[model samples]
Target: MSNPAARPWRETKEGIALDVRLTPRGGRDALDGVETLADGRAVLKARVRAAPTEGEANTALIRLLAQEFGLPRSQVTLASGATARLKTIALSGNAAAIATMLETRLGAGRQTG
Candidate 1:
């Protein structure tokens, strides 16, 4: 399997509005979406699967973010849109650091929620 990294996405001051393609339960957690790069370039793609449920998908998202950023689950939080398909996740520490982590650790795999 390829490392869940390398894919790139741009970061913003108000946190990232990820173009996520969520796979509700029985899916996989990988970076799958189109996002502008930090350098203002248009790069697209990454995939993550963790069914949209009552905090289930959010939990999985936290885990994935932690794994990618090498941070603890407590560090990541769903800043907004928990019930909606499009959600906003806030990464503690540094936004740029988290963005780098996502760019590096985004690929196909099974991530439990």
Candidate 2:
């Protein structure tokens, strides 16, 4: 896992706001782990099977995150970077729980950025 102070997610009013470096058409749908970017920004590494077209990959990402976080699709929304590789995902629910879950899950799947 990356440094705790540099983790890519933060507790928001509703839940957590996550910075993700998404790879569409990534062969398989999975969260690789957490890493710090070249500029020192932390991001979660995630790959989706769906291609980046007609919002398919975005939808797939939402579904993936929702499923990963055990939240409904409605709770997981793209907060920014719709057409870019780096996306900000907003997860709505218990902020603390979601943060803990993200930390635990990402730490378990940790990988170098």
Candidate 3:
């Protein structure tokens, strides 16, 4: 069966590439859910309390994702969109495990409109 996590992430040779829509300077750090863009692309909605300046928001996002995926900070990196709300995150680990984890996590709260 195709992975349900494929909506927000795709398996890569190194690990997985995740698409995220980040909300910087949010009240707290959390993954709101999965959202489908107008272009038919799915993205994870993440929020961090840190401001956008000085890469703090990006740092917070990495930390939050690391915690969520049970990985070290170094395992999660911002692959693109340093200045935009849409971002690509590179996570290094077992692709299957990460995809499973993402599927399980996303299953609880997926929003499409």
Candidate 4:
């Protein structure tokens, strides 16, 4: 069986790549947890209070992630999907350490409906 904790992220030479599903214009910014899609892809569910206009939601997402991972905003970047709800985020740092931090904060395992 695949490790659930590792499902939402992939290790990269520079650090780690994370797949995130964002809910824009949410009442508040928060991490909803890991969600397994119908296609069996796992993504970290997050919400931001900012509206999804002019990249506000995307900026908030990066901020939220930076805070969650205890990293500077400069260390987090949107790797792809800037205009879509599903986004790819790249973090610059130690891959294992970031993975461990993700597991600790978001819990280990995949969440499926």
The digit string of per-residue lDDT tens for model 3 on 1-113 reads 44354378988899999999999988999988888888878899999999999999999999999998788998899999999999999999999998888777776246755
lDDT of 1 by residue, 1-113 (tens): 33333233335575443434244463676554444445543333333566566677768766875675577777667776668655556566666666655555553232222
Off by over 4 Å in 2: 108-111
TM-score of each: 0.55, 0.89, 0.90, 0.91
Candidate 2 local distance difference test against the native:
0.86
Tens-digit lDDT track of model 4 for 11-113: 9998999999999998999988888887877899999999999999999999999998899998899999999999999998989898888777777464644
Candidate 2 vs. true structure, TM-score: 0.89
* lDDT comparing candidate 4 with the true structure: 0.88
Q: In each prediction, how many residue pairs overlap at the backbone (N, C-alpha, C within less than 3 A)?
A: 19, 0, 0, 0
**Leading candidate by TM-score:** 4
Which window of 10 residues has the lowest lDDT sum in candidate 2? 104-113
Off by over 4 Å in 1: 1-21, 33-50, 102-113
Best by lDDT: 4
| Candidate 3 lDDT trough over 10 residues, lowest sum | 1-10
lDDT of 2 by residue, 45-110 (tens): 889999999999999999998888788999999999999999999999998888888777776246
**CA shift at 61, candidate 1, in angstroms?**
1.6
Clashes of 4: 0
